[model samples]
Target: MPRGGPVPEFDTIVIGAGMSGATAARLLADAGQRVVVLEARDRVGGRMHTDRAAGFSVDLGASWIHGIRDSRLWELAQALDVPTIEFTVGSFQAGGRPIADFDGAGNRMSAAESARWVADVATADRALEEAISRSAPGDTYLDVTERALDALERREDALDPERIDEIREFFRHRVEEQCGAWIGDLDAHGLDEDAIDGDEVVFPQGYDELPQRIAAELDVRLEQVVRRIARAADGVRVETDRGVFTAAQAVVTVPLGVLKAGAIAFEPSLPAEVADPIARLGMGVFNKVFLQFPERFWEDGVYAIRALGEPGEHWHSWYDVSAISGLPTLLTFAAGPFGRHVQTLTDDEAAADAVAALRRLYGAAVPDPVARWITRWGEDPFSHGSYSHVAAGASHHDHDALAGPVDGVLHFAGEATWGEEPATVGGAYASGARAAERVLGRPVDLAAFAEGIRRSEV
Candidate 1:
């Protein structure tokens, strides 16, 4: 038995303490509203964690500050004087052979081969567009990609089965890497969504610094797992493992995966409009296995190495962190179903697989990795999965529905809720600011924070 205490009250309670929640709380607090942030994790940065290892700041979650042109994160980095560097894809390999290097154009091949590949890719792209346009409501991106590959094979008789399989596997990995879900699970129509234009950049200091800076002055409670949200006539009550807190409004910025898990119960259940989209949208896993080597034995100047594996192999792609971090480190990614599969393996097993794959590419004498770190986003209770994606039957409108406020008492903001820029840090930040504007009843000027970004680039 414990003594009773008065429930803490605030104008708004922001949940999750990630980018979106921090942004919303900061905005609300800046406007002089009594706001509090509840984070389930022990730290403030939810999906953005920077672990220091082997003399490097390794981003364990959410590494890239993508889309530098319009990226709020880039802008914030500039303002905060956080160091960042341009991340460019350098070399690519398939089936233990150097395939090509990354040019502005997406393919690497000889002049003649490049020309043929480009033409074939264009033809396949057009066929895919047509297929998607004519596809039934339940059609998936895998269906479109497969249809396009079939057309490509038929049109190009010179393409042998091996070459066709290579192309198919290449595109499959590309789709999985870009969308964070297997093509079979992605919505074909949603594949048409435009990406934000900009160069990709990485934070050398740590990606978590962005959220940390944004949360510097806000009232954030960590290690508080929000269990239930009850909206009443007077206000909204948020029940957490720690205690109960009341607020005039609440912002739920938990990841879509967590939402899908129904981790937090809503009293007077969420409306069908809100709940339906949650069911329709898909959560994806993109896990990374970082290995630190005693020496840099791999080829220099290469940024990315794509191992030509089966469509859904965990060792499909590996990033050369030495090129950027100057630390003898190799980062491997396993996305979609493969990522989940990798999560099931033990740390040593995953590390050994990564080393074996590297040896296959770099020769048998390649030294073993001295230190290793693996990410299992699927196993993380806080995140559940890596990010959000549009499922086979869902569209961008479902993102809108997931984002929409309910009864003016509850607001939702996260990467999943971002319509145009889902699964990006910028999208998550934008969504948080938008939710704050909703609560404030006025548009907030977040551009000022991003001014340094433009200036720094210039």
Candidate 2:
């Protein structure tokens, strides 16, 4: 149905041209509705921003298509002919291959020791499952991990306290990397439903290509930072740094961190139902430090190089991506409390810390990086954090609540609003399509419009 007034500038206004907003705008536009997308950043891909200032594309934001089969973004990639490379489950990247692990002394740990540590993780997981089942809504993983691990240690076959704690920190770091939050802040039972099953893939052409392709045919206005949204009886009046736009309906697809920060004001305030979830859901920081070297100094064919010891676990994992772009580059990650701590340091300090950690594993043989790319997503005004996670007191229902539409004129869409798979491009795409469906009062399922999006490529 046509809007109930003089045709507005756009039938629907979508905010944030990230995957979610882009999907909503594309679908609404395909259905023949005039859709306009407002994005704060100069580029269309939001957190999917990829940097080529180093002379080659490296994703400064999201880098993976986590799952393929159920991923709407995967469908988009296939339909758009976007190239991706698989990192199969058995690959060294996923820890299937033997890890190149070194103690603080720069001595390589035996493969048997690494395998034992990996097996310990599975042992800890069994305890975690028990803890999760017994835990209450407000209990955190850190709280129950202690009790669960304590119980495991009580068993006759358990390892020593030192070894168990070693595996514990490893487990903690891995979870932090996954949810982008410290284990203490994560809800024990919250992530029980957060699993996505399928193979993982990365983009050789850069992850931004996906969002760029989606935004190409849409009316995307970049650098238009939205500050206020007022509820109009028949529509919404959106005020941004650029200008005010009134449309019959609006799809808000900004990052959850942006919403949590109250970056954009909603007139009369969002209802308690939506407002509560925004407050309850946790915003987590996950950062990356990519260093390009003059040459590969580490062992050849090795995918991961981990340095083990106290005060070194935060910068523990490093990946050899020289194989990807033919550049001698190694990338490491920091997440949770450590990620936030790294953000507090100057670029030089962070680089030094990364270098020092690398030196611990490879000794003084490691040379200075020729180039570096460090991310501070927590400090980025438009993002505020890397992703969203279920806090100790929050549940999946909060995600569903945040996704709820307001007054039929205001709809919400983003990775955070996706209960099934939050904090992923696929989730963002699915959420955006759902918001567009709400705006249109109908469904244009993924397959239905894959051709329309593909045709627009011409």
Candidate 3:
């Protein structure tokens, strides 16, 4: 019913033109398969959008390649000859005053501070793993897991087993730094540990350039939001707001949230196992608030400032875009539950709150911004959130459930479905490649790619 015109046909149909779908479509098309990509938005790069209306480019979606050291996206940049700039994560200074390095005192955490956090993270991960391992691996997985985690909090190996609840509280606060704070409850626990690669890069020209360059020669139909998929014994029927399309195989690369939200429905309904993963895998909200001031206020030359707030508080971190290039832009990051709440505020309200937060740390010299831009991936219909991460007690196997194809025809690929590094752009690319490989009936070089992904963690 969402279809408007005649139903064209194809060998493969990929939905959502973000990194995952784009990669999947390109590979499939290059492999001599006729593919049609359906996107709800008017443009491609669903969450990797960059706006250049202002003098400089601002990423309305993904700003950085995240961690660049071993990133597949970084490798793609090299292959495509795309230029990039480094984004430094440095110390915190406000209003010409050294508030302190990264500490709970509302300053950028120092190397020591980061190491402390890392240790706590390692402890938390282990605690979760031990909880799962201790549980009997049968029908009572959900119940046993809950009990194990509750018991693990009392173990002496914990960061603060004596204060188990407080330890989980602190772990939640720190995970906000690693993943978006708005992530849902634990769906799958420890499959593997994917860390941030030492190298991280940002495109001075813009991240948007990469997708456009890769898609320049492809036949992309803009503004076609898919609404349904009717799979018959003969072929797969795809419906969208633009038109109807039919294909032998369909690779659905839309965000986890889109599937969970039921933006697109299936005729007979996809198997519960397939649909359940979407419901279980949570999408995280990471908001970036950018502002341009008349002049630079802090001179620490630090790339990032971590404002350690009380547990469960938002606006605890800020990035000095100026530090990277001495530009007039100031960008701040908010993740986790606090970030979800932040998505509900108006841009003006969000900016006003951020200004107040900065003023508290930086004094009055940092006046109101001349121009303000806020990225709210949470509320977007196409991508309900920015990226994906595991909840406590959830393992990588849960994600593998999403990876399983339906009738060897319907494939799922996205950052959320990646097992090694589930949230990065490189993970999305790798996931797409894996999905393509699945459709072609080939064994993926998981070991090689796993090394590459791990090498590029951020």
Candidate 4:
């Protein structure tokens, strides 16, 4: 952790101290391998950032831990004694009307609907896995992604002949809104399983605390900007704006955006197998504009506001974090294209828009925020983007390709690279533990690692 000393390289080095990188560092360190985590940002918790300057804490990056019971982060939080607040699901207000009250129905899954959706996703997942296996010896991720989606569509009718068009359109729209692509900005004749498939979790206390808890005992150098990674037969040399450090093996856990932008150059350029996946995998920009009000303005308890008024407008969905409790913070989400557009606006502009939207729904009880924070993951050189999502015609296999080791010296870990739960904090933790197991001789069952992870910390 020293700033100035002999370049101390290790058996492995993990880059980017986000959930993925931090988890990998913990597992490796626990395994007793000398490890170093190179973080580009001044602070820890890559995307899990929380701003508590105001009376209430606002998450600048990730705010929720989706799927708590099965989440490794949940166990980590319990081990660290971090507070856990139940995630409340209520009405989603859109178009000046409540869409549906999801409090009781939030966790509801229709028998037919669940079966159909699951089957569809499973077929797509299988097709993508096949495509990855059949990819040309060194095909780029973009090439593989295209083929993967094509393969899914080729077999689409078999999955659901009656709902072919519906399923295709369903996947397409999902890719636009959820896959990090701006809605309606893109068109795809083929379907993307990776983009359409996956589940989500929410964190009541915010996702940032999970990482801070995990990094509590580690030696982390804050405000460090990694510039380059030099790999040699002897060891790897890592150059950062803060200082240079060396480790036997380096786990590069930085965001895919940084990897794609060539923010941290390698002594030798990465191969297509390594570099292409980073490029092909999309680093989505999911920004949240948190606005604090003096009083609860709306009659509805805690609800989600979905803005679908104009043809092209941002602020798609807003949620009252205090739905469970009586907090005054209203958190809203805009991803893909909308998030990018909002990023160009000023904080005041963004805050004003949120307030205006509230006034439209709740009258005038909600005044301008006493404090506001806008998440700029896309603009952060270290993060480059929010979380990674598979684009149209892309597959999760692209992330799998990135997960493979490069020269056994440069290891990668992060949420983007996770095959399952790529966007969750638990996925990052699992990826980190997997990387550590690889560095050490220990083997872990991919399915039950979280339970074990929790047990280890507990």
Candidate 5:
């Protein structure tokens, strides 16, 4: 095929050069199939961008390798000789001081009281599980979460009203972050569907390295935004901004947010099973704001500091990047509704809010950051939000529908399609491999890749 000649037909066309797409392209190409990857952005790593800023390897997109055991990401990192460090959640801070719990009036809970609160929260969780199991018609996760919190509040008589309100706010933030949706919009039953067992690990070299390594030898077409996917009787035609590419099989690896936004129009239109899940499944926003300081100001051994604030506040959780990156950097996270709200603010405004929140903890003398970076995944055309979650009335079956292929022509692969581990790089990698297996008509031994990680641990 010449450069300007008719678009060369490939055995498979993988869309969006993210973890899933890159993995699929690599696997398919290695299987002796001609593959071409189409990516909307100029870069190969879609939401796995790693850039050097202020002399530090900063991951602007995906950060954590998540799990080591049975993790494809961990396996890939091992193959590439990438270093990883265990990431642990640290202490909670309020009003610039370490505390288990704090009231609005600046009173902190004693160790005994904090222990009791933890027990109460556990009880509330059990109650919530029971409530979700026996949920009535029209019941929303928000209703159940509030009911659980109210039950806990009523049982804890020792706490003052102000203290109770503060605890409630904290619980709200925790639930929203876990569900990746506002309490009112989350499905209580589906919250535990995607839970995976294991400690999270960080890629010190940068999370993007895994995808970049996989896509190194693949024919990836950058800045080719796909507009329409028309499946004919014999093959599939992918119309992009640049040109049309035909392939016997096409794997759609774009983010759930982009799919929900209807960025690519299907010629025959997606069936109800696929389209309905796309509508029901929620696209979550989990953006990060990184601030680099000249020196570390926060305490050591504390990976995360919880800044007590009202519900839906943008800067509720602050991560100490100094622990892993060996740099004086504080990474703040905004998720769910708060994350969406933060996306609406200007870069300076969002940075100012995060700085003010930090000042509340560190005092007025906290020096201004020498460099700052904010990520707005919601605003990006390729990835409208961070990841995917089950909406209020949706179930895990929605994920199955999203992953299901249509007419053996169009296949879907992304983090959202992996119901067992949705919204993680590991899931995205597995999904891509699974999609390639579907095209190959045989199961690939993905578990074999993790043997190295298992042997290293032993």
Candidate 6:
């Protein structure tokens, strides 16, 4: 809460004005504490950027609400009355081919085929679960999957070897898409974190609105790229390009990527518990290539497109996000290693590749794009990569260590610090609130802050 009269310093200095910092600052200030939010970029939302360019409001970063029930974000969305849209899974790709009908539902995988697949996919899911259940500590998801796949192949009723491979690749891509890392990098034991149960949704207007609203009543200083954090006689001293500020306490909400990159220097050096995780935990790569075409060439009612037969893993998923800009827009994703590889391409190269992939699926009717926006989170200085994931041999307890306070001088908050919902906006915000509580020496209901949120008029 950047609220309060002019003061020489502050009671708390919240670093990085993303969802986490914004929530921490707001909660602390409302509780009568002086707080200042320091953001590296000249904006409030960190990775939740709602890029307004070429007369379109497009989210270059996060867009979806993975789960809705018991969602702090959903509660806040309701309080703010943010406009939302639901995109049901409408297409599938089997053996590298689209099951969606081009003209209508007639070409789609038939009901019988759909039922058959449902059963097969269900079995695959069960295999994954069983593998996870029997996995040894420190085992990677890939290891668990291999064991499951081998057992399935030995089953008398197993499908052809090619089909089995397809199923394996399907789950591999899924984990890559969801965790933002290859299956080999995922820790089998850390996979099943708590989650909300409900339909998935996205902000058709812009996901950035949530952070913008939460930070409205607070004082957020933009373009203040933090470089170093140190313990001071008074409290904590934060050094930024613009200047320096000292506060009674500091809450760092920067992305785990930033920490992993050693961007901010710590004064006495963080303890082994914190430093170990920062070194061992994985920072994943996930990029987006949003293309706005001259006209819609794909079928209507298709929310997503997945092609297992794609030559490369670059185009992991394509989400139709025309609702945001009312244009013929489709945003495709690149995850895992390809997510990193795509960063090497020039803008034209990347956009052209995305269009080429679309052509393969939709035919030559796919025209040249009108406008394009691409991201390379792996190259961003502030956020070194997309997000955090529990890497192989890394325990979910790593999140706990990252969140743990250092010498009662430094507190932590970010998606990487929360295990239940790591890599999620809601989890980040909750971690912020929790950090603020630690400084306030009290407990506060997170739901109470939902009232301060509202959708922007845009």
Query: What is the C-alpha lDDT profile of model 4 across 355-374, one tens digit per residue?
Result: 77555544555676766778
**Please, what is the TM-score per model?**
0.89, 0.95, 0.79, 0.74, 0.89, 0.90
Total colliding residue pairs, candidate 2: 0
For model 3, residues 37-110, the per-residue Cα lDDT tens digits are 88788887878888878756787777666567766677677766677777634321122222233334445456
Error of 1 at 82 (Å): 2.0
Q: Judged by lDDT against the true structure, how good is candidate 4? A: 0.62
- Candidate of highest TM-score: 2
lDDT of 6 by residue, 328-443 (tens): 88878887888888899999999998888766666678899988999999999989888898998898889868997887868999999987888888778779888988898899
For candidate 1, lDDT tens digit of each residue in 19-40? 9999899888878899999999
Q: Which residue pairs clash within candidate 1?
A: none
Residue 103's lDDT in candidate 6: 15
What Cα-based lDDT does every candidate model obtain?
0.78, 0.83, 0.67, 0.62, 0.75, 0.78
Model 5, span 304-350: residue lDDT tens: 65544342254666777775567688887777777888888998888
* Candidate 3: worst-modelled 10 consecutive residues by lDDT: 91-100
Q: Residue-wise lDDT of candidate 2 within 306-390, one digit each (tens)?
A: 7655645778888777756779998888889899999999888898899988887777789999888899999999989998899
**In model 2, what are the clashing residue pairs, if there are any?**
none
Clashes of each: 0, 0, 24, 20, 1, 5
Query: Of models 1 and 5, which has the larger lDDT?
Result: 1
Candidate 1 residue 73 C-alpha distance from true site, Å:
3.0
Q: How many backbone clashes does candidate 6 have?
A: 5
For lDDT, the strongest prediction is 2
